[model samples]
Target chain A: MEPLTVPGMLPALEEIGRYVMAAAAEAGLDKRASYRLRLAVDEIATNIVVYGYQPSGTEGDIIVSSTIDDHVLKIALEDTGPEFDPRQHAMPDEDELTRPLEDRQMGGLGVYLAFEGVDDFHYERVDGRNRNIFVVNRPSAAPAT
Target chain B: MDVNIRSIDDITVVAIEGALDAATAPIAQQQLLPLATAGCRILLDLTGVPYMSSAGLRMLLSTYRQLSGKDGRIVLVGVAEEIQDTMSVTGFINFFTLRATPEEGIAALKG
Candidate 1:
């Protein structure tokens, strides 16, 4: 599918999600995989709008593209915002995961969930742009139990 | 996203429809968080919610914390399959009671 380029705004998230979900379904992803694919895209796209563009007071565009190769669907989000690598963020530690609800912090779980739902996540800075790539492997030919 | 608020007996049910992403989460927080002050039994009906990101999960956690502080209870009803898996994987599943339907959730919270 052709890549989609949209302004880095909160409302643009749903557009990106729709495109990704369609691509995932076309690639023969199951319901579980399809849901995670859209969610991971939502997480990254949101960061671009909120952290990357919003804070800088500069307008930017988020370019989303998808491809399916060998039953693996890869979605890449390239943004014109600052250089941010989501893969570098620390995963929630044992304490963060095990802490009681009251003591638990409110943030950080988005990044964690973004990574958790995908088989692999990649990040890179190219030409002064932030590119975050997420990969989801299609279910095997074998039927799900 | 559209939030439909209703009350069944003493339980407050918030039914959210649409994707609960960053843009829409604040709307939910604004309407649902205030209910925490009442510290009454709450049921989050996600049947209409087709998708949820981490922002949605955080909202649920914060709401759970608020209710827990007041010794009140919150249950999630009609949770989408994907949302349920996300909660289970994030360990958020243990924090609140989840039921397959609104009736079940209300029964659990009221019991």
Candidate 2:
């Protein structure tokens, strides 16, 4: 599928999600896998828009592209906003996740869940843009299109 | 996202329709947070919510924190399977009572 370029803003998240869903559908991902991919993409895209772009007081576009193979489906999000790596962010530990609501820390849960939901996640700074790659293994029974 | 609030006996039924994600979470928060008062019972009807991201989870956590130790109760009804799985992974599912339907959720809140 063709790559989607959406403005890195809060309102553009819905468009980003639609692009991801379309890619997932093209890959013939099942409901569970599709939802996971969508969540993973949504989380990182939000971070790019909210933390990376909005805070910098500059506007940018998030470039989302996907590729499907017999083995896995890969989605990549590229943004030219400030260089930020989600992997470097501190995720909630097991204790934090299990802690009572009042005792749990609020930040990082989204990033944590985003990476954890996918089969594999990778971050790289290619040239000047930050690229986040998410991989979800296609089920064996799913026919290759 | 659309948030509709109605009173059922003493419980406030907040029905949210549409995807509950970062784009729409603030709207849900704006409408739902004000209903979290001391000793308030809230039944969140999510039958129309086809998808939810961590933003929605954060809103739920915030609401839960507000009601904690205040004798307030909150229940979730008609949670989609995918949303439930996301909540389970984040451990947010354990924080609230889940029911299959609004009737069950209202009963859970009352009981």
Candidate 3:
């Protein structure tokens, strides 16, 4: 089922995370698996708050959900804030992942991190909204970096 | 949102207990900034903190930058596994000296 809004940590992200994570956990999702999905949710939701609000002239909300019937936890974040297809960004190069701690140059790693955390990721811009859907299957429960 | 205060040698310690995300991060950042600037050494005890978002990460990064310039440091103590994992995956585990316990923050200051 869907939890509360996970938008921008705007007084609701953690609450959203708790609810979704609880659902995932109750569905037999492990702590590592649950944390990975929720963290990815937080990261993507924050991205919507930051980028979705700019360059798009629209604003939207973050939606998180877990489904036992589907044997999957699908986190779909929708924001009318901007037309961002996370598919555009390349995965971060692990060899170059380590950078100066304060270097803002590597700020784009959030999406890469989220991508790594999930089983499958897709980004779509439909009907004037940017939708990012990340799917995690139960069997492949490893929390990849 | 609750804050507990403790003194460990030369550093003033503040243990933040609660959510450090977009909503609460600003509050925590504001509360820590003035004290971190006015003091010589500071330690943020994150023992009871369940979660911290990138907004919180930004505040910590900003604080580290500020403290580093003044010959002061922000030591993190009792970081949870999830927090530690997040920091490491983001390549931030070694950015600052991390202690396993709050008392170690004082010890780091002493050394």
**Which of the numbered candidates is closest to the native, going by highest TM-score?**
2
lDDT of 2 at B34: 89
Residue A140 of model 2, lDDT score: 84
Output the lDDT of residue A40, model 2: 88
For A5-109, candidate 3 gives per-residue lDDT tens digits of 544436666676787588666656677767777777777776776666634554456666554543566667766665777767665566545866555455656
Q: Candidate 1 on A1-145: residue-level lDDT in tens? A: 8999898999999999999988887778888888888888898889888889999898989999988876588999998887788877667876787777778775667778888878999998988989899998876762322
State how far residue B73 of model 3 sits from its true place (Å): 2.1
CA lDDT of each prediction against the hidden true structure: 0.84, 0.90, 0.71
The positional error of residue A53 in candidate 3, measured at the CA in angstroms, is: 3.6
Per candidate, the number of residue pairs that clash is 0, 0, 1
Give the winner by lDDT: 1 or 3: 1
Q: Local error of candidate 1 at B104, Å?
A: 1.3
Ranking by lDDT: 2, 1, 3
Candidate 3 docking quality: incorrect, acceptable, medium or high: medium
Model 1 chain A: lowest-lDDT 10 consecutive positions: A136-145
TM-score computed on alpha carbons, candidate 2:
0.97
lDDT tens per residue, model 1, B1-111:
999999899988899988898889888988999887655888889999999888887788778767775877788888888888887777778877889998899889878
True contacts kept of each: 0.80, 0.74, 0.43
CA deviation > 4 Å runs, candidate 2? none
Query: By lDDT, is 1 or 2 better?
Result: 2
Q: Which candidate would rank higher by DockQ, 2 or 3?
A: 2
